[model samples]
Each structure stands twice: as C-alpha cells, then as structure tokens.
Target chain A: MAFGEFDLIETYFTHRLPQRDDVTVGIGDDGAVASVPEKSDLVVVTDTMVQGVHFDQDTPARAIGHKIVAVNLSDLAAMGAEPAWISLALTLPEINDEWLTGFAHGLREICEYYNCQLIGGDTTQGPLSITVTAHGFVPNGKAIRRSGAKPGDWLYVSGTLGDAGLALAARQHRQKLNPDYERRLTERLYFPSARVALGQSLRGIASSAIDVSDGLLADVGHILKASHVGARISVDELPLSLAVTESLSAEQAITYALTSGDDYELLFTVPEAQRGLFDTVTAHSPSKPVCIGRITNEPELVQLRFGDEAWELPEGLAGFEHFRKTELSQ
Target chain B: MAFGEFDLIETYFTHRLPQRDDVTVGIGDDGAVASVPEKSDLVVVTDTMVQGVHFDQDTPARAIGHKIVAVNLSDLAAMGAEPAWISLALTLPEINDEWLTGFAHGLREICEYYNCQLIGGDTTQGPLSITVTAHGFVPNGKAIRRSGAKPGDWLYVSGTLGDAGLALAARQHRQKLNPDYERRLTERLYFPSARVALGQSLRGIASSAIDVSDGLLADVGHILKASHVGARISVDELPLSLAVTESLSAEQAITYALTSGDDYELLFTVPEAQRGLFDTVTAHSPSKPVCIGRITNEPELVQLRFGDEAWELPEGLAGFEHFRKTELSQ
Candidate 1:
C-alpha cells in the first residue's frame, strides 16, 4: 500500500534510529532541538546522495544508508570534530516497508557504533535521495583545516587507498579473487570507516587535514591550493596492502591510490618538528599514519618523483571533479 | 570548458552569497562552524524541494531559490529561532549559468535580509532538487513547541490564510483579476513572510505553536497530537480579507482558511492569564494575532462550529498529504 509522507516518517524513521539525551526534541516536531555541550563549537555538514548519481537502484538499501551516513561522518572526522547529532532529509519514490526497515536498521547500527544521535529530519515524496546534515563538536581552535600546512610540513595518509576504487571497477565483473582479499576490497567499498578517532587524536598535532572523498591527488590538491604550497609525492612511497597489490599491478594500484575516490581515509600534514612523534602516536593507535610526501615552498605545482626519474604533473591538483568528467576512461 | 567542482565553487558560490559574523567557518571546508551565543540553543530545520513535485519547470529560478530558503526559515520561525546560517545541497540537471546566477541572487537577497550566512554546501549533478538545512539560535528553554498547550489554552493565528491556495488554483487560468487582490494572493503564494518576529515575541507567552504550512486544520492538528488536547474553532471567526470574501463564497473561504497550505503564518495558543497581553504584543506588529478557538480536555477530537451547527473534524489533521488528495480540486 502507498503511504503518506507523515506515515512513512513514522514507520521508517521516528523511533527506529538511535536517540541521545542531547536531543531535547526529536521527530514529529517542527524542528529538532539539540544541546551542544559548553565550551565546544558545533560543526555542521550536509551531503546529498541522489539516485543514479550517488547510487543505482540495484544497490542494497542497507549499503546505501550506510555509505551515505558514513560519507557525511567522514567530513566531520576530517575537521577533527566528534560526531554528535544528525538530521536526515529523505525523499523516496515510494514507501517500501522492507526497504525502509533495512535502511533504518543500517542507519541505526552505524549511529550506535559511532555514538551519533539521530535528532530530527523530514521525509517527503520525490526521487530517491538522502540528505544528511550532521553536527559535530570540536574544542575551540582545535579543528583542523586545509590551509595550515607549511612548506616543511610532512604529508601523511591513513590506511591503504584505491581498494574501494578497484572494487567499484570490478563490482559488476566476475573477477577471481582470494576470499580474504575479496572481502577486504568489498568492505572498503560498502563499509568504509570514517577515521574519527585518528582524526580527533591529530587535532592539535596535524597542521593541515582533509578526508579522501575525491581521489588523493585531487583532494590533496585542495590543500595545496588553500595552503599556497607545492607538493612532491613519490609513487613508490604510496601505501598499498597485499590485497591491493595482488589485485592490481603496481602502476594501476598507484593510479588508484592517487586518483580513486571514496576512500574516506584521513590525509593530513604534520610539521617536520613533529615528525618524530609519528611512531609514538601510532604505537597507541590501531592504525598507523603513513608519510607520503613533503610540502614545498614553490607555488602551484604538484610533481611526482621516482629516484632518477621525475615527471611534471597537473598544477596544484588532486581529486575527481563532480561535473567535469563523465568517466575515468584513461 | 570543463570546470572542476572546486573551481566552479570558487567561481560561483564562494563570495557570491551573503556572510555574517556568526559563521565561524564558511564554505570551502569539511564542514561549516557557527557560534551559538551564550545562554542560547541552536535551532535547526531542513526542507527539500524536488523539481517535478514541489515546483514546475517553468517556475522562475529566483522564486524557487526564495521558496526553498523561505520554507526552512518558516520552520525556524515556528520554533522562535533567529535565522543564522544555511547549508545548501543543490542537485541539478546541468550547470546552467543563467539559472545558477538567478538562483544565487535570489538566495543572497533573503540571506542578507535575514542576516544568515551561506556556509558550506555541496553541488552535484542529478535531477533538479535543492535541499536546504537552516540553523538558528533561540534563548535556552524559550523555543515554543507544539506540546505545551493545555485544556484552557486559547488558539490564535496571525494574518489571513488561503490566499496561497487560491493563487495556485488560478495560476494557470490567469482569468481577469482584481489587480489589488491578485497582488495580495500572489504574494501569499510567491513571497510568504515567516512570522519570525511574532513567534519570537510569543516564546514565553505561547502555550503551543506551529507554522501554517500544510493548512490551519492540519498544522494545528499537529499541536493537538503533541499536546494531547482537542480544539473547537469557529468557522465564522476565521480572519478573511474583503478580496477573499468577494472572490469566493463564505463557505469556500472558510474551507480554504482551514485547509489551504503554504500560508506560512503562525498558529499558537495562549493561556487565559495572557489574554490581556495580546493587545499589547500585537499593537506594534504588522499582523494581529486573532483568537479563534480554545483547547478542550477531550482526547482526540477537533470540532468546528458555525452559528448553531457543529461538525466533527478529523483529529490531528492538516492539509495536503503527499499521497492524499490534492487541495487544488477542492
């Protein structure tokens, strides 16, 4: 049976998502009321996932819910903000009980794990799209930004990249893979983790930071543009796992690491002075940050170097352009 | 020429919109940060407008932009929040420079008037849709909610309603019009003024409150549902202009007042003790708040009375359900 908008919200959203004490008002109100703790600033981020653009109809509802919310949380993590409350604006083609249940279940699981509260949201009838506006808190003057990197800053990236890209390339293709590697790559695609803890820990330590939503090269280029500095990245120094190495050639893997989007990994810059603290910081953490390159005094140039061979690349660039390219044919 | 998302953002959105000091971090970041003044709580609301569902393709880009932002501000006004910052997620069929320029201009005008900063947002390619998440600040514990009305509380509404409905109905026909009446009705449809000032003034005084978005009958029903109270409204007591009276029969006007959506006026309740305060509060306001009904102890019944006749009405009812019958026919 077709459901009205209000009824749909009541059934799919209201009580299904995790709630928190900080949310004084929840669903069914004109707007949600949330209380940010004293001495903390609120970080608000909104991202919209559209059908055919962000995801296809055949994608599982649970995975769509997880990825949408995960991508939003990644923004907060990039700013060194702790996830607090989120409001969802979901527009659906039609109400499907099973789909709603799976979507809410997936959303709830992540909120529970992340300690983020689902405060309030709106549900309407339209093309299937999910717009999540998440709120996070950061200590005063502690939130990281992309404009803080200096010439001598060391660039670091957390975890292996390009696996998610590779998984996407092979999602429809029947490619043989080792069970462990296949699972790892698929998890990277469907259940990508936001580096919240790692980002929060780097609050006062990292000079500049960004989340890898667009490919590493493009996203890091944002830092270079904002920071007004050049960067030299060594393709050989790029991080890759055995799964990634086994799945793709070294050159292909490097390309994915540099240009594949949706990694959700934290890329940051640390001053040379704090370079020694890297081992100390990683010893206490579950994952270590890998140093990939160094910032340069030269302006508007990003070069790649491999021992005796050096190549001049795109100027001050990295990442995918949403409207520029149709596909990665190269 | 192909444009990178970053370049498109810098070229079009970065400094094109208004800015306010309340925004700590504006666009070009992982998230936007706005400061909530001491002793105040943040009020947030979101609204999504889809192309085919909310507005027609021929609808002016400027009007669409204004309506999208206005509707969200209306929600904040219902809660007595001062509009502060708005983050937009705009999904478009393509980058039409003329449309973007017009839309941004319209949005900028409202932002300037409301003193709201255009913070971080996303621009992506998709079927045309704009999702706006607006934030405001309210004094702690002063936000008027729908759950505060008591049995003896008197129901009131600011300004006349139903003009928007009439305008929508007559938009395509464009039959000969009374110029004055046409101006007023079209204003109701195209440029609704959210009762922000009045709602704020009633924060401490109003027992319950809501914005007339879906229609008076339906929106007030939300308050009834939340407060667990019933109401008795007099059809003859509904405020109406001479234009509306001349344009339609008394019964039709009453029905429009009750069920016509898009008025964006405030409907609120005040206790008997505050009856004397109404004149004083509304004396300087542009629109007078007129008392039309009273709350009852009954559980789930809303009744309408006209002279000696009394008719039972739907409980917790409002106007124009997304999947329900369209108001245009009635």
Candidate 2:
C-alpha cells in the first residue's frame, strides 16, 4: 500500500482519541477549535527536531517522536502552564508503515500522559523532521516567564542534568560505559520527561522558570539576560544521575552536567522569602527541585564555582546554538 | 555573517510588531503567552511547506514565506475565525542572510496586513520547510463548519479559481503563456489572498465553508462527505481570470480549475432562505462571492456539468495527496 497522507493519518492519528470537551472540533476540519477558560492565558510554543541536527537519522522512530513532543512540552513546562493541545508537522523521506506505527505509539504515550490532544497537523514528504507546536493554558497573571527572575532569588533545577549529555558522549564514542549504564543514560537522552508537574507546582512560588534544553550554564544564563541579573552557580552542587557519574570522570561529568543539552528539565528561580515554603508547594512533584545557586545583582555575569575554585567554561564552548553548524553537538 | 538561530530571529522576526492587546507576551520567551476573547472559542490551524513538494527550491524565500502564512490564514478564513497570532517553525539547509531577510519581509507583510502577530518559533538546520500554526478566535457556537451544509443550500465560491493551477502548469512547461500572462498567473500562484473578510461576512449567512487548497472538486468533495450531502457544480459558472484563459485551452482551463491546488479561495454553501439577505450581509467584502452550484440530497455524489454534458473526472486524479509520491502534483 502507498499509505497516502490521509490514509496514514486515519490509520494512526485518528484512532481512539481521548475526547476532551474543550476541543469543540478536531482532525477532519480545516482547523481545530477549542476553548480556554475565560480568565486563563493561552501559551504557545514551537520546536523543530531535524534529522542529523537534533537527532541521528538512524534513531528509532518512536524515540524521535517522543523527543520532539517532550522538548516542546518542556517549553510549556517552563511557562508554568498546563499543556492542553498540540499540532504536529511531520516531514518524511518516504512512507513506512512500521516506522509510523512506532512513531505514533511514542507520540500517543506522551500526548495521553500529558492529557494533551493532537488537534490538527500536516504530514508531508521531505527530509525527515518533526515540528510540534504545543498549546497550553496558564492562569491569568501567573505564567512564570523568564523575565520575572530578580536578584537575590534562589536558583534551582529539577531532576538530573548530565545523564543526557553522557549518553550523547557515549553515542559519539567519546567515552564508553557498561550496557546497563549505557541503557539508562540513553533512555534519559531519548525519553527525558518534561517537568510539567514541577512547573505547575512552582507557579506563584518560583520567580521565573525555563527548561534546561541547552545545558545548565546556557539555560540559566538565559534567565540572567532576561531578568537583567547574574548568577553564581555552584558546579559541585549540580545534580547528576548515578548512571552519568558511574560512566564518566568527575571532570567529564561536570562538563556534561554544565554544558549538556536536551535534558528537558526545568531550571527556575525562587525568592529567598519563598525558600522555606517551596518544598511544601512542590511536594506534589516526583522530581525534587535542587537548589544550586543564587541570583546576583551583577547583570549578565554568570560566575561558576567548583568548591574552592572559580570555574570557567572551556574556550569556544557556548551551549547549543542550533545555527552554529559546527558546535551544534556541544 | 553567519546567521545563527537567535541572531537571525532577533534581526528579522523580532522587528517592531504592531501591538495587539490580546497578546500579553510577544516573542523571545520560552513560550509566547496571549489571551483569547472571553466568551469566544479559539481556533488553531497548522500547515507545512516543503521544498520541491510545495514549491520549487529556486522559488524566492519571500514567496515561500508569504505562501505559508497565506495558506494558514486561508484555513482560519474557512472556519470564519478572526486571525490573531502565529508560531513558525523554519528549517533550512544553511543560513543565507539574503534569504532570511526576504523571508522575514514577506512574513511580516502578511502578518501586519492581517493584524496577526508572530509570537514564537523554532529555527533549525535541515532540508528547507516552513510550518506555520495560526491561532484565531470565533464567537461562541458561531464557527462555520464543513458539516453544516444542508441539502437545500446554494453553493458559492469566493474569488476566481484555476489561476494558481494554470501557473503551476506553466511552470512545468505543460502549457506555454505570454510573459504578461505568465507574470500575472505566477503572482496569483504565489500570492493568492485568503478570503478572510468574505468568510467573516458570511458568519450568520453561509451554512458551511472551506478553503480551496486542493482544487474545487477535491476541496468541495470534502464538504460533501462532511455534510453528508451532494453537489452539482456548474462548470460554466466557475470563474477564471484572463491570464488563465489566455494560457490554456478551454478544456484544459476547466481541468486546471477543477484540479489545481494552492488556490486559497473559499468554497461555501448558503441555504435558499438566507439568499435574500446574503448580499446585504456580505456587502462589506470587496471580493463578491459568486453563485456556483446547488447542494443535492444524494450524499457523497459531486456531479460536475459543462453546459449539459455531465463531466466525469479522468481516472486516478486525487488532488494533492502529499504522500503517494507520484500523485502529489495530480
């Protein structure tokens, strides 16, 4: 079978969708119609995953689907929003039923888990890539924007940071790990969960928030620039998974923890006044938010401390700039 | 100068946007936040354009950008929704500053003309493709859906059709056109306007509506299936421009009109009772909607008539199924 656009969509996408009353009209229409509560703000975010750039062409179709949705959901998570809907634009080199089945399976898992509906989308023939635009809602006047962080705020990160980076290094043959460690690390890289609950819990508590897709220093630095404040992050306090620690040297692990991308964790700030009560409000989340540093008055300055030594990023490393062709991996 | 994602976006996409009160937060954040009108429903649509599939790689970046936004706006028009915001996901093989400038110029022109804001997006390295998700608003319970066409509804189509299809045929050298005719037809191809006002004007007047992206027959066929009714289109009543008529034989022009994709016109149905006041209600529109056909009781049957000789579409002509690698153009 040729598996045309409509056929593929009907077979995989139109299967029993968990109905939502808010979705007034869905798939077959020119556009999808939905409703948001009267006083809530609609939050929209888009992310694209390209073959060979964001992921290797040989990666499993399921992981590719999961990572694309996960990364976009992370953006929603950063805004302290509750993800409600998504639109996917999938471009493929050719039609493969098996590939699509795996892709749909992974995609549905995330969509159902987040209670987000795939409202509408486009599927086309081209180099394989996925661009997912996620829509969510945040209570009016309560979205945790990156610009709201203030000086003297306590900086924290949810979940672990370097497991994804270690996985990437292993895939590149920059390091080696046992199978069990490798499996765990690669799973972290491929299926990293979005801190949706953590983000929702932090609302009205965290001063500002952002997802850690592009390493700790880089992602945290975005907060510095947006809020016109600086940060002194304690590298020794940066959290790492056991798999990452067991697989690489302390120096290498630190590098991965500080500079690795695609972790999809939330990095946010809370004022000193809210520190004592942060745990009480955030206890609903499975991932513990770890305090790593403090926001400083020095604007745009990010000072890294590793115990007694003031740390510096290796020369030429500046996070994951998607357009910097050569340094995309770093 | 190499245009990284942030730099290219900051330079082009982040230009001075016209202020929209509904948009609480503009671009540059992890997620863009906006508010929809209270008591109104939100409408969302997404479309993707890929190189060599949707347009030639040599096509100007500006036209590609314009067509992407235009096509998405047409989707919103089909739903009788008010365009509000858009999120773009752009993938390119490499950074070309000239291309980015031209692309942004075209994108901004449409967004400004429509009063839509470019809120958030992602840029990545890959085969060239543009996916735009448009957000709009419709009054509660007032969105004109495809399923609303009734057996007694009189059919109407906005603007002319086939110019874009004729242009596509001209590009492939399947038909030759004079330079003046070619210029006009190609411009029609590249810059077909979405019938936003016409659709909005038809709010309480038209029974059902849809945008003609996949030719008149194929697109209207969708309405037939949705409304569970039939249609008899008068081929003689189908509108065509001088450029299209001059570029092809009468028979060929009819084929192109019925099968050509990318024409962003609206095909709608209006019941007989509303016919008396339809003109008065739609007076605000500059492009007068034309009476084209009538709905029938025989569901899923679309009978096309050229004068009196009932026309049958040639075997195996399914319009613009992006999959079916060989059938994309047909």
**What is candidate 2's local distance difference test score?**
0.84
Question: Which portions of model 2 miss their true places by more than 4 Å?
Answer: A1-3, A314-330, B1-3, B313-330
Q: A143, model 2: CA deviation in Å?
A: 0.4
Whole-model Cα lDDT per candidate? Answer: 0.79, 0.84
* TM-score of every candidate: 0.92, 0.95
Runs in model 1 with CA error above 4 Å?
A1-5, A172-180, A311-330, B1-4, B172-180, B311-330
Which docking band does candidate 2 fall into? Answer: medium
lDDT by residue (B1-330, candidate 1, tens digit) is 112455556666676567777677888888887678888888888888888777778878887778888888999989988988988888877878889887877787787788888787777777788888999888888888999999999999998888887777677673334466887787678777878788888878888899998888878888988899999888788888766777887777787788878888999999999877866887888878788899998854688898668943344343334324442111
What pairs collide in candidate 1?
A217-A318, A218-A318, A218-A319, B218-B317, B218-B318
Q: Write the per-residue lDDT of candidate 2 for residues A1-330, one digit (tens) a residue.
A: 112556567778878555678999988888999999878999999999988888886788899888888998899999999999989888888878789898998898888888889898988888888999999999998888998888899999989988887888789888787577888888998898998888888889999999998778778877888899999899889888888787777777788888778888999999989987897887766789888999999998888899878986655554333334444322
State the weakest 10-residue window (summed lDDT) of model 1 chain A.
Answer: A321-330
User: Tens digit of lDDT per residue, candidate 2, span B1-330?
Assistant: 112556567777988655688888878788999999988999999999988888996788888878899999999999999999999898888777789888988888888899999988998877888999999999998888999999979999877889888888788887788577878888888887988887777788889999998778878988998999999998888888888777667777777888787888999999999998897877666667888899999997888888888975555553333333355322
